[model samples]
Target: MNITEKILARASGRQRVSPDDVVFANVDKVMVHDVSGPGVIKVFDKLKKQGINVDKLWDPTKVWVAEDHFVPSADKVSAENIVKLSNFTKNYGIEKHFKYGMGQYGICHTLSHEEALVLPGEVYVGGDSHTNTTGALGSFACGLGHTDVAYVLLNGKIWFKVPQTLYFKLNGKLPDHVMAKDFILKIIGDITTEGGAYKAMQFGGSGINEMSVESRLTLCNMTTEAGAKNGIVEPDQKVVDYLSSRGATNISLIKGDDDAEYEKIYEYEGSEMEPLIAKPFSPENISIVREAPSVELNKSYIGSCTGAKYEDLVAAAKILKGRTVKIRTEILPASISIYKRAMEDGLLKIFLDAGVTVGPPTCGACCGAHMGVLAKDEICISTTNRNFPGRMGHVDSQTYLSSPLVAAASAVTGKITDPRDLK
Candidate 1:
């Protein structure tokens, strides 16, 4: 069995399982954010009124809540939602809540890793689709709808149809100018957005082993753009060390069986890859940096669970060190802790000196909720997960997705310029 099947089987108390098999598995963790938590709480209330009383969550400690989607509240409604979430967490005894304006608050996925809430070989679920980002820790993490989340809260179990696994064998090392974002963009280009729907995308081989935990998280984070059920990488010493530094102990590591079944296998030579970009409107509409047309941008943004890690910001700061941005640009750290670290490291100073606005740690502009919403006909370059129409604001506004290196370089040049070209 593959890692996914093995984890599911163990959670379901079954000796073995196969693709498409329905199983009721115990959930080790459940995460809900302000955007989705209100809906879940509403459902829980509805259930109670129907005589299906759920006095409390299955395990309050195992459930985590974060107010991120519209932190600082973009509107009255957003504020009310946070209040609802706060009341629910307080009443339900959910001690793991990261409330708005709290020192520990951050994008849920980023905090989940920093807090070590999701561990290897565990079955976890979140209200947001990007929950798969946690799989970088070697956990079986995926997203569920609000109602589904409510069900898990009530019963501590959820049902799933096992997904077939697609193996990605990456080899060799990427160039200094290239990044996991470029590599993932290339994969989405090859497979198209819907290629891996209802399937598990398992990454392995020499290239993955050589990448840092941050880079690995970036890779797994975007698998949702390919419509995958989940994306995972086997845990190694690097992951164990990262978790340990965050106070995690007694971790359970799981690996794919040597004879694990896979629906298909794709191989790539990382050395041959270059910085790439996903053109306006679709993550799969990819083009090599040098080959892409000259596109002038009205704005550039570098932040999100997908691209706002410490390493990613450091890469951008290196390029923006003594330069000033030609267009409007914003840099937001994914978490409060990351923001503080960047400040101590002088990365935030570099960004400010470069004329980039450093904002609070919120989903903010990434989800078009606030901070940096786009105007009609505006063009922006961003280091974010999606480029769907109207994703960042107005329906006519366009967003091109790229690595932080590309985003920073383009901001300096005010055009779609390759980072290597600056060298």
Candidate 2:
């Protein structure tokens, strides 16, 4: 058994569990943002009509809320949903609500790490697909739909059929020009979007260990595009320090056993990895950034749970310093903490000097909800994870997904260009 099995086995209070074993594991933490919060409320309302005891939760302190999607409300309906979500949380006695315009608000997944809300060795679930992002902390983190989240809220438990694991071994440190985003894009391209369906994608090896916790978070965040049940990296010293710096206590690092079993093992040489991109319509449609076809890009977005971390901003700023963008560019830090760090570190100045717009932290436009969505026929190079049609705006709009470095470089050229090809 591997780390995943061990976690689930212990969670279910069993001596041993294997793949396909269904167990109602006690949940450690659960979350719902403004979008899913409202959906969960609707489920609660429906349950009330069914005469269930929807008045109380199993554990209010274990439940947290985020106001990310459609925040800085785009329309009357969105505004109303935010209000409804607020009331629901207040009524439920949930205390960790990160609201928009509040000092610490940000994307839900970003908050999961920046605030150390989800600790290692815990089973954490959220109402967004990208909730898998928290798995980088070595937790059995995954996403649940509205009804599923509501169940966890009331019962403090949810059943899952243990998933088979796929191990990705990254050897050595990646080149400075390459990033975890590029490595993940390459893996998704090789496996295709449905390749990891219903399986856990676990990363390991020297390269993964060498990567920063934020970089590992980037890797896990994009695993949703590969149709993975979840993505994870065994927690280590880096994970401990990251969480501790954010004020997390009782941190524990969990690792797979030396005899851990995996369905398949894929290996990659870090030096061979290059800047990669996923063209529009699907995340599996990938290509080397330098070999990309010529296309007129109307915008470049350096925001989202996938890319707007502080390290990502540093990468983009490194490219944009003393240079201006040829296309409209926007940089939204994943959280207010990241935003403040960029400001203090002068990364914000570099972006502003490069003529980029720095907006407040939100999941804006990443899910095509609001704030700088694309127009018809508009093309964009973004640091986001997905590239499906209409993902960032009009149904006809196209998106190219890349690392922050590639996106920043393309912003300076108005087309797909590698960071090394710039200047």
Candidate 3:
């Protein structure tokens, strides 16, 4: 069995086991966000009225509540929702409560790993679909609906059918203009939207070693788009170093056996993957752009839980170091801490000097209805998830999802150029 299998086995109370087995496992962590928490809270209230005891039911220390998304709320309804979420946190005594401007808050996925809220070999669940992002840290993390999250909060356990493992045995290197984002977008395109449903995608291969930690995180973060529980790459030195640097003192390393059995294996020569972009409505609808002439973007956004990372910052900085953005553009750090670190490293200066507006480390433009909202007939090239119709605010707005490098390059040229060409 591979690392995911091994971790699942241990969590399932088995010394060794295979895939698709239903099991009752303990949850090591639970998370909620303002966008999803109110829904979960309503369910919890109903369940409690039906005889579930909140204080006696679950571990308070294991649950986290973060207020992001419509932070400082763009409207009265959203502001009321945030207030309700805050009251629930205060009443329940949940140990981790993150307000919007605190150094600890960001997107649920980004803040989880940043604060070491998710740990290796643990079963973690969050309210948002992208909770699988925590799987990058060697945890068996997955997202759940509000009803399911409420049940877990009341029971500290949930049922899960083991998922078949899809092994991506990556090979080769990414093309000069292409980066990990393109690699993932191409994978999604090849597999289609529902390709990996009820599967555990275990990524490995020599090519993974060539990617930066942030790039690997981006790859795993979007696994939910394929309907996968989570995507994982076995813990390596990079994982250990990253955890250690984040003050994780007792991290456990999980790995697969040399002869581990996999449902399927895939080999990707990433070096052959061209700069790709996923057009709106479907992640698999991707194409290679050898030049930037195909797009006339009205806005370029370069941050999200998936796109806001240190390596992503460096990549965007490299492209915008001495240039100016033609269209309105915004760069958001994943967390306030990440923003401070960027400032310390002078990456923020590069972006500011380049005339790009840098927003706070929050889910600003990704939600679309808030900051950086689009105008009618506008197009945006963003580094976020799900490019559905009206996803970037205006119903008439079109979106092309790509890597931060592509976003930065597009910002500079006033069009979508391959980053390699700019070099």
Highest lDDT model number = 2
lDDT of residue 298 for candidate 3: 85
- In terms of TM-score, the best-performing candidate is 2
Residue by residue across 1-423, what tens digits does model 3's lDDT show? 787778777876888777878877778889999878999878877877988766543888899988778875878998999889888888888768888755577778888877877777888999988888878787888999999998888888888888888888678667666778888887888887798898988777888877666777888888887788788888777877887888888888888889888888878886678887888766777878664347678888998888878778888998998888888889998887788889999999999988889987667768785878777789999888778888878888888888999899989887877887784
Q: Count the backbone clashes (under 3 Å) in each candidate.
A: 0, 0, 5
Worst 10-residue stretch by lDDT in candidate 2? 250-259
**What is the C-alpha local distance difference test score of each model?**
0.92, 0.93, 0.82
TM-score of every model versus the real structure: 0.99, 0.99, 0.96
Model 1 stretches with alpha carbons more than 4 Å out: none
Full ranking by lDDT:
2, 1, 3
Write out the backbone clash pairs for model 2: none
lDDT of 2 by residue, 135-204 (tens): 9999999999999999999999999999999999999999999989999999999999999899999999
**Which candidate model has the greater lDDT, 1 or 3?**
1
> Clashing residue pairs, candidate 3?
173-270, 173-271, 189-284, 292-416, 292-417
Cα lDDT tens digits for candidate 1, 1-423: 999999999999999999999999999999999988998988988998999988877899899998889987889999899888889999999999987576778899999888888899999999999999999999999999999999998889999999999988899888889999999899999999999898998888899999999998998899999999999999999999999998999987898788999999999998898999998899999998899888679999999999998899999998999999999999999988899999999999999999999998889988899999999999999999998898999989999999999999999999998997884
All candidates: CA RMSD (Å): 0.9, 0.7, 1.7
Candidate 1: residue 131 lDDT (0-100): 97
Model 2 misplaced regions, further than 4 Å: none
